[model samples]
Target: MRTNTFLFTVLVISIPYSLSADSFTFFNYYHDHMVLQKSSTGTTIWGQSSKVNDVVHIQIDNKEVAQTTVSSHHIWEAKFTSPSDNTPHTVSAVSSLGTIHISDVLFGDVWVCSGQSNMEFNLHGVLNATAEFADSANYPNIRFLHVHRQYSASPLTDIDSVDAVWNTPSEKSLSSFSAVCWLYGKYLSQHFNYPIGLVETNWGGTRIEAWSSPDAVRRCAAFGRKRNQYSQSQLYNAMIYPLLRNTIKGVIWYQGESNAAHAYKYSCQFLEMIMDWRTKFNTASLGTTSSSFPFGFVQLAPWREGEANLGFPQLRWSQTSNIGYVPNGLMQNVFMAVAMDLPDFQSPYGNIHPRYKHEVAYRLYLGALGVAYHETDVDFEGPFPTSARIDKSTSILTVEYDRGLHPIEVRSYNGFEVCCVNQTTTFCNAFDSHWINVTMTSHSFASISLDVSSCSHGNHVTQVRYAWRESPCAFKQCAVYGKMNNLPGPPFTYYVH
Candidate 1:
């Protein structure tokens, strides 16, 4: 009987011992070749451990950053002061279980590029992709952390996919990398001469609602039906929430194709998504105020079927008009990269995925240079019409733009259109014969004279729109450039009294 008791006791002891043998380790994000955010404070290094109350020491480049004990929950975290210089460093996390050493880590700006298929469009599919793949070896400092596509019923602490890891830019790595992100990173790295880290979290053909939190989606009454249509908060819970601990410079989004059906509600939904992310990220990382980081997004490119139904234009207007909805403090940090001129024109009907990703990336890079980097001499935004007035006697309409204007490439301005209140039809009179001579009065104003006498109705012109059509390409002629950077102007619309 005593021998039997001894064996049973041994079995009991071994059971708990075996369970405790699980080793402590760093999160998947903290891996070799990872680039931490430079020129910023409050960068965190975190992981999980099986041992409780055990100290975890973090060292960067042989210098100690901090030492913290693993909590009862088996999680450990430590924040380190980021070095001001851009250089490669090795980080080591030592615990009772073992020592995890991350090598070739870089200190530089890190950005999160998230959206649908366009953002997920791989570099391998882009034009001149072969040349780009061969040339990728030139920029070793640019690193990419690609998050595998995932969805969960509840928020997960970490993703389980093996492909999610930081990778140095190379021919092999470039194959799966986002094309727009690669171009943006290349430009920033070349211009700034520093390391640039990109966190790619996107799924092809996914809607903005799919990426948004359930709470955020529920807050908008317009999305009530949509909330029940799919698994609410699946993507946000699985993909985005896990990265809340990561410190980033900003986010560049290229979505809106899926949300075109609900174009009217997009303004509020998009705003809420931005605010929700900003609030959650800031609160999780720094416990600071909302709207703490910058956000830049690409306005939807013109699609073939969308033009016939006028869906793309409505979505574009929704995106542009909501820029002011975000608080003023954060509004200045918000940027919209226009793609009205970047769509594929060679096709009888334009393709949704434009071949010219370089132009898209260039536009985004210019915005980042001005907003995030604070380059004083960069002209990121095109001419935006601020105000307009009508002279009833001469039947002349003068519109004032924000950025200084120049003469359009073509003498004829094809984008300008007019609408009269008395018109029975809702459609604006587009490319009408009434529009005579359009002239640039100064560096900031344009004048358009209309022949009201030719109108069937005697009502004065109540609205004027430039490049506001579904497949708007007319502004290509009036591509005004800023003197600082010489980038072309974006399309605009004006309401007249």
Candidate 2:
């Protein structure tokens, strides 16, 4: 393998041993065109060696940097500082057994894009697939490694296999890959002008517990353990555990559809899972000692269902731990992309899977730019309600919002609803609530005034909410939006004060 010209090569003689090319090889995840996490202290490199006690040497551009002895289990790992330059370098691993080499490796940020079916949704299913595939060649530095779907009852040291190697963006490679993963990376590449790597590991119709560690799931009081093969902790064992050795910038998840039945429990379960992942990845990955890695996720999108118990709205709220927006007290260094306004009622795949993934990916990229990259100038958050108060004398309910890059644009108040309580309770049940007419009286942009005289409970109204149904309004027609960005105000339920 070629060595970097800036680095000096160190020569060492090795005695021949009873080992073949297959006996000494890098892990399946390490391959040509891969982007290693750029770290000044250390970047981890691992492989399997056939002979125990034998030393495995790792080299970047032919210069030996770190070495480690093969364990009794035949696993070996080495840590060395990876170069921060953008130029491609060759990586080589040498041992008494044999030498393995891969070409065209780069140092850059790597992100894990994971979750359920929505995350697994391929670019082929998107509406702009044709144009996207044609323009893929423009993003040669944006690459992906698609992990093959698998689940195990116990944690695995390495994955069994992958659907694809570290592949650069191409018409063929981009077509069948995860749409959100590719689009997000593409944006990063454009912004930073550096190599961007994305690891797409997700499965369709999988629950949060399936992807969460056993300890994480146990922390949720409402969650119960199951011994089934495809149950709790199975996906985390097979999918997430194997990638712990590699340092990642952060993660962007798209899920929660499968957890709708237990939406209330998600407020606790989701935070537990994020904390668990941060702990494990920080401890296992070399040079990543920080436990507060940036995490971004997509809130559940609206669907054409009338059943109040379906729990899509509740799931979205719980996604934020009932706080509405992220980076709150419950979740730090985290962000969300609200999708309630982007409903897909007639997708070819199904109503649940939206075809407008470009918007979702754009929003996710915006979050990454703001939270992960620390681009303070970028505004990604949608308009969020800060407070809601009712003026019984004026018969108007004024809701104040925290604005982002633009002021609030009150469209039609289609999703606004008021709750009249006959008895005191924690939250007004969705089934017991009814819709009321709301008209914009004042021309205020930051704070909106709604005429709520039509509310049956009148002064007895206890709560106010917007877009609180499986399908609250037509696609992209939610009541409130940003004046310029068109980012809809997120779905929220606030107590009247």
Candidate 3:
């Protein structure tokens, strides 16, 4: 009887502790020792732990940052400033009562990589993924924090997937890396060797509104009141809100499929969202702005009419137009290895997924070279037209771009036809005729000169549009690297400078 009672009593006490160790109870284990990593060199983190005899040991980079005892309420807290460089650090608290360790601790540039299906597409789906994942091995220095998908009006402090490890690439877990982000990190890691952290937070079918906060959407001029429907900040509540105060390099965004039909709104409104994100991120004493955060991203890849969206085509054009509004350093850079010669642009036109994610990563690498690493000679952008001159009597149109490789091929995509401002063009108009052509054939000049004797005049002599009608994405003059072909140029709106 004595033996039976003694055994029963021990079970009563041990059960709670064991369950706490293995289960998700009593404040998410993730939240219990919630880590606040790299706020600002000027800021500090403070929190409370609820337990008795708890010996709280605060750690950074796997070493002790601070330590203390739990109060009567069994709670404790700590504070830290931003890290010195792009180095990863771990933060946690282990009490006599329990233990907590957060994975993929990083101190360097941390960016939230988000988007829809393409953004959600993982490393495993990309070509050479098996080899890349295997060869890259585990990157203990490059950490990744993935937020689980959840819908909620109020923000959540403790999310579903915690203790997320920033392990190196491998066949088993590499599939989780957003192909774009993984490749981006590989390029940055190889060049900088600074700790790189990726916060993977994206919903497969999410719209731009879904990823934004209610307040952010409300502020957008285009969303108007309708934005309220998906604008309650549900995503940030589940994703961004929970990871507040964690410093970041910038955001790599790859969305817009849901609202592609509304690219016009996206041009300005989307940049507004970028402003919002930067405002939120920069809100910290950390004070990092999107303008300065190195927010570079992919301009969507080339896709044929049938595969993904049937026959619609304005979406891609809208994205190209928006690039003009995106801040200089933070935009769709075309000069790099992004879409140059991607498989999607080639023969197998049916596959919607561009499995060669490495190319996307390659583009990002170019962006980092120019942005984060501060390399000036990097070429990851496209030509910006600075001025234009129209000579009606001479039948010549001279156009100058802000930047270019020069002697670039000019044409209407799918053989863009030239027509007069009065009459619509015929099939013959689509092909280059006596009216439209390229001139001044040297690569050294910054501007391309074309003779338009055969082309149509626009609303006035003051304005002469080139290929003003709908056009395809095909351009023969892509850079030698060819990443710029995915997005065809928009019908240019020229003004004399």
Candidate 4:
């Protein structure tokens, strides 16, 4: 009697195990309440099934869309036309094992919010967390998929588990969602009146090398030790590669604090990273017309005071220069969200994480409005110094800017600093005396008159730096802004000829 009972128990346990092994299931991202990329031509759905070579049927809104067979590797994929209209529809996948139904899937714009700690910063950690969390229930169409942090030495086919699945924003989820991404999606959803999908992938204190492919980093000679020391392509393999097949509108990056030490090499490293992502994700589903997609990023906020060794300024310059230095054939779609004025002034000497994430989000939204959406009327950037000319007669440097810039509001002329190029030493030295004065000539112009007589190197001012300190706000009270939009002028240094 005991032997017979043991045999029956073994059979019962083996039956369910065999049945489950034969079943098919969708990728983790294809769960219910997901949002498909509406702007793309089609949406690609992929899954795995135990029954290889079996036919798989796909349907959207009960209409047959595609039919394909599972591959020898037990993997299957189907592409379905996504309607331009942002309406919710039911998606289903049927195989020999069974039929899986996904409910409440919408077609809309999808954006990937990625970076380090700032991008990973949650809504509950920002200012006015309670009010924002309570108000999040109003936007039911905004969905979020928070990709769990993971790393691997080799590329991964899929993540082991996802922290958060696709769901409409609620008080519970909003509190933990990325604050900048949440606010950005909220603004876009209100303006476009469509569902917005955000994929949050980030790791705190991670350098740019961690997010880039190993081969790409190895190609750049400047990243010598970085290529071998860190786990090459670990984050890219585990976090990004799995989602390359998914269609996305663009990416919003908010990193660089960790890469500040390697600021000189950032321009090449960052550009390579951008091109790498564009090349990998440029499939039919994600769109292939353009070699690159729109990429917007936040400039590092102010940090420690007078720490030039930190390379914050150098990193900021590299970020801005990348807007114009796109790889050949790739579209010039890079944009920057300046954060010079967004840092917390109370603890400018210590605080690196600014509490005012809403402003940062708004700035990123403005950049997307102009660069991605192509809104001509939107003034997305502050007054940028376009060209500078030095008048030998009067020793005055006049800097020209783009249109729509208002007069620079100067609390004090302290941010302006002059560096004299020493012919004998071949080095530029800061002027010892008060050798510069700034004057707002017009609504869109400014002139800095150098005191050539007071300069130590006779009239040879090699460079002029404006608000270029590590913490200009804290030390020099650097206050310059666009009168029209009230946006602060980005910190910059100019070479005088």
Say which candidate scores most in TM-score: 2
Overlapping backbone residue pairs in candidate 2 total 1
Q: Write the per-residue lDDT of candidate 1 for residues 1-497, one digit (tens) a residue.
A: 01111111010001111225557777777788888876446577788888889999999877888899987767787877877777778899888788889998988888899998788887876778889988888889999988888876666676545364788877787788889998999999999888899989888767677777765676564442343213456777777877876777889999888877777777767767777787777756553213458788887776653254555667776775533211234254677677776666553223777767787888889888877777888777776666777777666667766656554433334555556555444444433444322443333334334344333355556666665556665324343454444555555556676
Q: lDDT for every model?
A: 0.69, 0.79, 0.50, 0.70
Candidate 1 TM-score, true structure as reference = 0.85
RMSD of 2: 7.2
Please give, for residues 1-497, the per-residue lDDT of candidate 3 as tens digits. 01111111010011112223322122232321122234444333333454544567766556776666654543344444545764334555566555566544445666678776777788777767667777766455665656667655665544546434444456665667678877787777787776666777777756677666555666554442332324546676666654553456667777665675565556555555655565555553134333245566555554552243411233433444423323344343222233422435442323445676776777667766766556877665445456667676776656666554333443322212222343343222222232232333222336555555555444222332332222223323332111242332233334432
Model 3 misplaced stretches (Cα beyond 4 Å)? 1-48, 51-57, 61-77, 81-91, 94-106, 138-140, 162-164, 221-232, 284-292, 306-326, 329-351, 406-444, 456-471, 474-493
Per-model TM against the reference = 0.85, 0.91, 0.70, 0.86
In candidate 2, what are the lDDT values of residues 404-428, reduced to their tens digit? Answer: 3244444565667787655554457
lDDT-best of 3 and 4: 4
The deviation in Å at residue 21 for candidate 3 is: 15
In model 2, what is the error at residue 162, expressed in angstroms?
A: 0.5
What's model 1's lDDT at 460?
54
Candidate 3 structure lDDT: 0.50
lDDT of 4 at 463: 60
Model 4 TM-score, 2 decimals? 0.86
Worst ten in a row by lDDT for model 3: 4-13
CA lDDT, candidate 3, residue 284 = 37
